[model samples]
Target: MKLNKILVYVIMILVLITSCKKDIVAGEVQDTEKKIECEEVEETPKEIVIDIDDIYNSVDIDIGYVELENLNEDNVPEIDLEYYPKDGDFILKKVSDGYICVSLEEYEDENALEDYLSPMVYRFNENGKLSWKKHYDYKTHVGKIGQVLTFDDDSFIFHIDSYQDWNEGRLINDNCYLIKCNKDGEEEWTKEYSNSNRDMLANILLSDSEEILIIGEWKAKDGKEYDDIDKGLKEELNNDIVITKLDAEGNMIEQKSFGGSNDEHVDIVGYDKKLGIIIEAISFSNDGPFAVDIIDKWNNDFIACIDEKNLEIKWIYRLVGGKYTTNNRFSINNGMVYMIVTQNNRNRQHSQSLITIDDKGNASKLITQTYDQMVDKFNSLMILQNGDIVIGEGNQYISSLRIFDDTGKVKKVIHDINLVPDEIIPTDDGGFIVKSRRQIKTVPQPIYVSCIWYDTELVMMKYDSNYNIEWRKTYDRYKNNPYWDCVIPLNNGKQITEIKTDYRKSCID
Candidate 1:
């Protein structure tokens, strides 16, 4: 009986050992399955490689006026013109489809001597094909379209200066209009603001909440009566700055004006929901210099911050100097304002200086770079995400782009003889897109005789993180009129620019 009981106990122990071995194998299998599942869940994103050759080859150079004429296609519609249509102002914004361009156009009136200006907006597909176009015209009034702001929903808002005069040549009325349109270029709503003062639209800003901010200059209606040599001209005119806010549906929520004695013209430099609005203005001096021969000159250049909610000035900083040219460029980044200002002397020699302003509106000069040899102008100024300031300075022939450190010292200079950089923008990959004009001439003349004498091309350059030129491509559609070229970068590492014809004849003979 004892031997039988011991054998039973041994059988039970063997059964227990077999169960333990099965549980261990199941746990290992479960862990391996979990590892496999995790490996399937995570994925590495694919990198987008842009084919430079493909993009270059896709350019439609035959779409311009001259090319269309050469084709003798009557189906093509005439593009509207503004004054010098070839030199019209344009604003470009990237959309999902591609790019939307809003341009100011002036049309020649067969009955009248002066041409009437209007606004035209065009939509293009991802491959740069024209999808649709919307042209706005107020039969009698001339329109000067200023800027366009696009929303996430693919809708856009554009502002224009609308004015009309009596047949007797006396000014009747002038007004500003804001028009909102849908993705199809159909007008959703239009708002017109009529003020006793003459107002000019400067720029449109998009807020963090997707609201619209209209910035402009306002001059008293009485100011138009004063002559150039009038002693009380500055006192008579109430030149001020105007700021207006609009909701998503084109409703004005708030409007405010700020100014003091002396003629003041304000420009909206930057704005943020948290930091409010930043503006730069110039106040003309009344007593300093006055003559019929002399034109308008500024006495004080000031920068100010305004509260977004209250519309009250938070702080004001001023830099006193001689005449301040319109080439002033300023940008705001990380609570700091960077500016490039040109001060003109009595001899018409201009000197450019770089300065910075803190959140408190305290102004400090970074470095004063003078251009005594030729007419040096600041074409573009941009602050990188890493706090570096890049400035493009150029004359008619040569151009240089200088990268300045955070402390305002020149870190490096990128120079080219024939390239005139008109604009520079930062890319997501820590590089830059330089929109420049390349002029090729036979001799090193101070000035090219005519558009026909020289070959000109619009250049788009891509730079690496180390500021090395990766590749560059040029377009010769509007070879002579580089001023009309507007290059906008796309999210997919592509670009779109204006294409026109060089209609002017060459004076080579």
Candidate 2:
């Protein structure tokens, strides 16, 4: 009996031991599975998300509660105020001493059969004192100034277009002339060029090798009268872009023409050491040799690089398809071309694109970016020394600046209500200077209606390296300054701006 009881006890103990071993194995297996799951989670990559709203919110800083003025108290030097014979276009340029203001004048009578246009040149000293004022009286010749280029040697040149009827054969055509002058406003030499029956100068530039490049539109005489523009003759005329190269002595060296059956117009001209003379132009013909590579059959703008040595086209790239708005800007840095193209799409949607082209004319990169609001146009483009690009955009309600990196990412944005940037100039202290126009509403007086007249004020704003506004100034003429022509930076960290003062009040309907 005792042996049987002991065997039963041993059997019970064996069963208990087996149960304990199974429980241990189950727990080990559960822990191993959990370790594997954790490893899998760690191996998976996390998606990166960039919040554009955060970026915008971070950089959109308030300028201030009040608009500050940093302009020098000396004010724009006032010169001898002369009565304008007639309303005509004028251009103001910065000189070593002060400023040069040139305007075209004509007789007050518009219906006169025989009249002449005069080129008026005025030089103002640094104190707004008139140094010399003169006008070229071209008898029986209609004259207009295209551009005035100033040199460091106290000399200047003016690109003039003169229209006259030849006394020999009664032939009527326009002539382009380069009039060089000394600092004393004395004419040095006058060089004349006749490309076609009608020649209109667009832009002029001085190359690194001291060659002068003149680009303009040239049209052959098609048995039309000189003043036939009243007959809507522009549609029937074939306008070709002509580029003429001249030496320092005002002697023509070479001339090149580019166009098709349709009309072509030049918008901008720039020069680069590697790309030579770069031209941005618009083409309306798709079947012509120059327009063959155009993307569409209608309006298109393109960039062409011409070889400086051979005076031949190096490469051309067309901006695929869209109606490019005005104020298109471009800059060349480190032998690369950076352009800002604002286009109005067919669907009425406006978009701005940043294009980069290499020396081989290869448009390697295109970054199409749009703002939240409907973008009107990009007015200016500036390439910094650090390969960063700064673009200015202005619409009816807002004006802002966008800074982009080399990869075309928006790194920063600046907003200012009172600033509508016309030009963005970078300063030497790693900051920026923005030149813009500000519109102010004058208080109503007994003589004029309330809120009907608006005055244009030229504004200049300086920013620090951190993109903070250092100072803002408005060159307040206070009278009837309706137009802000241009602004130039002076060496002493000051700015000189030109305001076209018309005493006649302009009414805004």
Candidate 3:
């Protein structure tokens, strides 16, 4: 036949060249498995570079809180400074071979007040030198040194505030001292408390069986005790809201008072081994003159829950808003209780509300968040250890730091242009430590005459678990106001702030 039809066309061209070499080896094995899954997603590791440049050390000492102990057995970190001295009458004594600043010799006549303000305690030594000091003179005429509770057997507690001139200078009154030192700073017991009207203190909590919960703002020794509350309320405001529980040897055991008629204050006191004492207040249903010229008409925001064995009042959540609320900020994890709520209109803050409350108090309102066009101002609120909910907003030129997730949503916002946060601290590697300041304010013109002038600086930022900004520091100290910086974070990663520049140069001289 023609040689069997040319061998059947060469066996159909060898089966079409083996199906084009199996489709080019299946597209080069699917592009080599997508290049080994993109090199394992670029070797995954998101960010953490911390080298804060030896954490800025500056100490002329006027600070009021900064603690990080190891005291000298030398595992490093030994900064504990809480100073006070603008012009001295000295008393810094601690001797086992290291501190002795005693210099009191200027009490010459006419009431002897050559600027002697007292309450000091320094102990630095990680190269900032000076390893011991202690001073506390009650020759008061005004003093404050609140919050400094450290102990794991190093013992310490001082939440002071003294004022003096009781009924003699016709009344000046102020007292809320707690003082309990020892780690060689000496003094063991001081607990004061006072009342005859006008008390101040504001917040302190320590419990885990060590108990100390304070909270303040009470003022009534004259408004006729509102004839014993609730008759239909409106007894014309007198402040009120005090809680006191002490004992770890500061002894006061139990004391309570909460108001209802008009002004109530107490803005935070937490504790939760299952939600026992949580009080956060701001009540005022009418303090007359149409609640001070109608700007939201009157306040009302409560959240109570006391009863860690008879402190009474188990649950109360009231929120009745109308717009003007104020800087409230809170946090408590696992058992709930978040609360943020800012909302304002008498000039600024435009909206914010987080609200969570649980452990039986119920209340929910997880996220309201609004800031109209920016004048934002609620500064601090943290709750992270993984439940994540950090928030801190500011004004006069940027300062943000949002981060929310746990269903509250927002998840990360940072910002920080002129800096102003007041405190944030949350780390263990999930990074965050903000404490900002930087104010500027200069008005001085005839533009509606109000006379303003400030300058302050004092920021300290350090973030990383991906919110990256591994370091930032500022410290001009003060020029017109704010000076209460406190940073403390060490275990070798370095950080210890609170340089209170002599109370901002004694408030600009």
RMSD of each: 28.4, 27.1, 25.3
The local lDDT score (0 to 100) that residue 124 gets in candidate 1 is: 75
Instruction: Report the lDDT tens digits of candidate 2 across residue range 1-509.
Output: 34334434654655566566767986897799887775433334333343323322444422122344665434432243333223435666677777776766664456667665667788877766667788864422655667888877667888766666675477666566678888778888887666343354667887777688877677622423224444465556677777888887788898766767667778888987777898888787665536755545344778888887667888888776564534656889888999876665566466777878999988754567564334454778888767878888774246688888888888799875446677778876667777776654432233212222335666777766677777766665643456623445643445644335554222111
- What order do you get sorting by TM-score, best first? 2, 1, 3
TM-score for each of the candidates: 0.65, 0.66, 0.28
- After best superposition, candidate 3 residue 376: deviation in angstroms? 27
Best by the TM-score measure:
2
**Worst 10-residue lDDT window, candidate 3:** 52-61
Model 3 local distance difference test score: 0.57
Clashing pairs in 1: 81-105, 81-106, 82-106
Candidate 1's C-alpha runs over 4 A off are 1-90, 103-120, 134-141, 163-175, 195-200, 220-237, 284-298, 321-326, 342-352, 368-379, 394-398, 409-411, 438-456, 478-492, 497-509
1 or 3, greater by TM-score? 1
In model 3, which residue pairs have backbone atoms overlapping below 3 Å?
Answer: none
In candidate 3, residue 7 scores what lDDT? 36
Ordered from best to worst lDDT, the candidate numbers read 2, 1, 3
The positional error of residue 458 in candidate 1, measured at the CA in angstroms, is 2.5
